[model samples]
Target: MEETKDVRLALYETIMNLVDAGIHAIDEEGRTMIYNQKMRDIERMDSREVLHKKLEDVFRFRSSEESTLLKALKTGEESHLVKQTYFNNKGREITSVNHTYPFYYKEKLMGAVEIAEDITKIERLIRRNHEPHTGYTFHHIIGKSKAVSEVIEFAKRAARTSSYVLIIGETGTGKELFAQSIHYESERSRGPFITQNCAALPDNLIESILFGTKKGAFTGAVDRAGLFEQADGGTLLLDEINALNIHLQAKLLRVLQEKKVKRIGGTQEKPVDVRVIATMNETPYEAIANHRLRKDLYYRLGVVTLLIPPLRDRLEDLPLLTRHFIQKYNTLFQMNVRGITPEVLTFFHSYRWPGNIRELEHIIEAAMNVMLDEDMIELRHLPMQYRQSGHYTPAAEKSPLLKDRLFEYEKQCILEALEANGSNISKAAEQLGLSRQSLQYRMKRLGI
Candidate 1:
């Protein structure tokens, strides 16, 4: 009797614990049993009522026409993870993916247990990250690297809102790509996209360009649409925003706060609604310290900040990025560079890409124009600065001792694995066939 009672208590405890995991169970009869905190609030049903009532009637799945588990039982499949949407009794739409499998008693089919995970956030996130495009949309900024992908991921989230975005990175880190992509992905995609390089224009011309003037706003000014006026309903990319003079920063800040801009030498302040995306080669703080920009304006624009990584940090994507740049310039410059050799990739991986993507793009474009369409780019085709002499060959092979070499190899392997895992260390270590500690020690020793 005690043993039977203990088993019964175990089953009850399992149900109670499962409720904490936001899981739902449906039996062969299409009954709903929600046990998570979210369900409790959504359904407003007590645990006893949930467990005692027919799941379909209480949770609103009982009368459903399509039942996933019914098919699973019919097929006698071992298990399945299915994604589907359903509506509860309150007529609210719910999107969820369910991991389901059959439950058995003494090898007999008892029913099934379904663990459903809500994916509203995930779906919204995916829509934001991917752009439906004929070309490189904001979502096309793909990277297998965490540093790059995380920024892209954040950009998607930030795009769903109207907050000002400040993108900071070194030159050639693709800040403008993000800026453009953000505009194209947002609700204002159909609006005019205007871009102004605060650094490219002189102080005198800067104001004129940002805030258009009447026919005589400046010496060469025609009645024109300023960046703000052009970007009224869309986005204005303030590229190299830190290059603006402090005076310009103050003027820009007032426009940001007031949502209006005045033309140079013009009296009227044009009411404009533009999403501003500002990019800088360095931190806004540093820009402020140097008196290059205003601190208040910096804070106002940095509500959503993204830092783009230089190519050196994400060397794993070098081969892929090389091909992408090759394809791009392949069409642009009408070159026939097929691909880069593994030897070239090795050198590409080792060499620091100071100019980042621009340097890579430039190198590929230079090599492509000079090489055959079918020619595989070798070490010689790379920039002369990237070439290595024979003097270090012997030292390269032997200087780093076996342990150190092992450390180096281990670090590379760990990094690759980590990159593959989206910077999830536990997953990376599992993939490296090493304990997390072993991976950590080697990483620290290698300064990786």
Candidate 2:
């Protein structure tokens, strides 16, 4: 009878191995009793290496208290199609959907069996077809200063090439916006353009997401093309590339050199036609010194490097940018706001915008929201931080006499009244308890 039972168990294992999906069954003690070839391939493990090992010993679960197989066995509950993302023993990340069910014989509980399907391929396909398109062009970039114009010209030249490009700039200096413009203006604009932020994902996952993965390469892994393949024949923007670790940087350099990628568990390399554009928010040397970015990879990607000028360095373009944003917000908010006050412009010029153009746009949009029927943006609508800086004040040059200060204050009140009254001299004068002629005379004398 025991020999017959052993033969039956071997037959069951053979049948399970023939199935197309990953199948793993553990005894009541969580020891691997039946792990098929497909499971070995899905996990990129040798069947002989893991056949008799305990589940926890093979794959380190976060905690024994939350083990999925353990829970299913103990509670006699079935876990159906639970999607999970985790790292295997070798530190390769795997994303898969699993179904864990309790095994039983007649009325006697046996163990737990799990069936898993890797979804990495499905996700890549979805991203390829569903990613949003970038609609910006060179004309959308607003700048006229020599410093900015030079950067724009260089970017246009870089866009025409198929070589790798790198953009260096401070945060909020529009690095990604410039990248999008490059893609839209390039010859490959008709093809798909995909973007991936290197710093946004963890190191183990970023590599698989970039270079693709092969079946049996890691636990719960399936064959799938990564971002490189997804962006084939198009542009691939790797934002914050310095965030990738050194080990991964070496791997990336290989891909760039060969123009081919071998999936994490794949043995054969696949050729890909992709134009890469990398962006760095910090100085490249700093990243190298900190050991975040590899020097060789930097040389490869910096073939067409473009550095964007910060707002402070190109103050000459502030007026043009201000008008651009004002018109932008006017149409967006459906308001006919004319322009900003001269006092506000003075403040904008004198103040150091640490956040660059992004900060300026925020300030303008916030001020526009509070216009209250006034056609022009005023000093009071400005943020308190800007107002407290005293940069916009005429008193910055020299303190005025008491009479002169009073005259200036009176002039400001008259100007505000006129603006609030829709530039009606009679209404403004009435609000100020004066005749229209008196208000006009004050305006002329004070240069309001």
Candidate 3:
């Protein structure tokens, strides 16, 4: 029985030390019971300095209440993603986001445990600088299909206004690109532009990060501007806006309606001239129905909503998009790759591109890496998963008629010419070395 108990303790310690985040635990009397290696690295303290020592002796806080672990122990409550900054025994300052919980046995308090993720570097960088320039513009968007072209035109119009905009699309649909284009096009172009993923941080920390924090807002919080204040006089792109809990959404709506922000635990409201552009991966109506998004906030933000079409919905642009990615990889790889084979293009069109344009670009890049002296991307060059996914048709299984091949070739040529000419029938006809009427006839026969 003694040997089994020893082995269990060893296993628990091993697992605790292996965790990426710092793990620290203290008994009801506040003496340290567990201090894992990660905690040692985070606090720059040796185990000898921490283990069995009173929590107050190992770290200095403004008050006993400022220590989350101690607070949990005292209150018998759990706290998550609480930002805390303190000084270790070596007098070195450390900052971390922590989740602390109290443990009990037989209705009697035992101890408190804390898991801390070090964010000192991130906090310092954010304080030193606003986000880097948003390098994308409307010109960077590549597509010629009617669906994409219409959306781009609408986005250009939205770019001219300062009204809040909601962009809805699936993942990898370039919602940020549209958001940046609007910011650069508006009069606020010279001002700051900030982005925050709504789902990136926990509920407790996200509120402070978005609305700024006052010194006395919570334990260890310093007076700091949030993303909204940082983006004053410019734009704030909130990605995955639906990820925000409904309470925060209500706060956000209040901010939008009043054009002012109140810092956490602060009474004075600061007027901010910031335009918000929010994006969501799901439909707003569905999100509202499911209570993931507040209806009032949706109506407030959807003043000029833009729904970006998925890749599968606009497959007509596949060839043009593929060629663009080919040129991009060519410059990147310093190779003279031309284009993809018809069989590969057909396979790409048939497959449902769940990852959208990003997936297409990645596939092209992967195919180019595996190419060996082949100028064109063929079926053999595609990723193994794609080829074996049961969506690809082997050459032997496809129709092998010479007439059918000619028909597809001719149709593709006309489609490319029309795309190049912006669907101008006369220009496309001239480019195709045919009369306007003949091109129209072919288009009709080809069901284009």
Could you say which candidate leads in TM-score? 3
Candidate 3 displacement at residue 26 in angstroms = 18
Any runs in candidate 3 off by more than 4 Å, and if so which?
Answer: 1-35, 40-117, 121-129, 392-448
Local accuracy of candidate 3 as per-residue lDDT tens digits, 347-392: 9878878799999999999999999899999999988989886755
Q: For residues 173-208, write the lDDT of model 1, one tens digit per residue.
A: 899889878887888888766666777657876786
> What are the RMSDs of all candidates, in order?
28.5, 22.3, 14.5
lDDT of 2 at 313: 73
lDDT of residue 370 for candidate 3: 97
Candidate 2's C-alpha runs over 4 A off are 1-96, 102-130, 390-448
| Candidate 3, lDDT over the whole model | 0.85
Clashes of 2: 2
Compute each candidate's TM-score over C-alphas: 0.55, 0.63, 0.66
- Model 1, position 436: C-alpha lDDT score: 78
Q: After superposition, how far is residue 119 of candidate 3 from its true place, in Å?
A: 2.2
lDDT of each: 0.69, 0.80, 0.85
Better of 2 and 3 by lDDT: 3
lDDT of 2 by residue, 152-200 (tens): 9989988887978989887788998888888888899987788888887
Name the Cα RMSD for model 2.
22.3
Which scores higher on TM-score, 1 or 2? 2
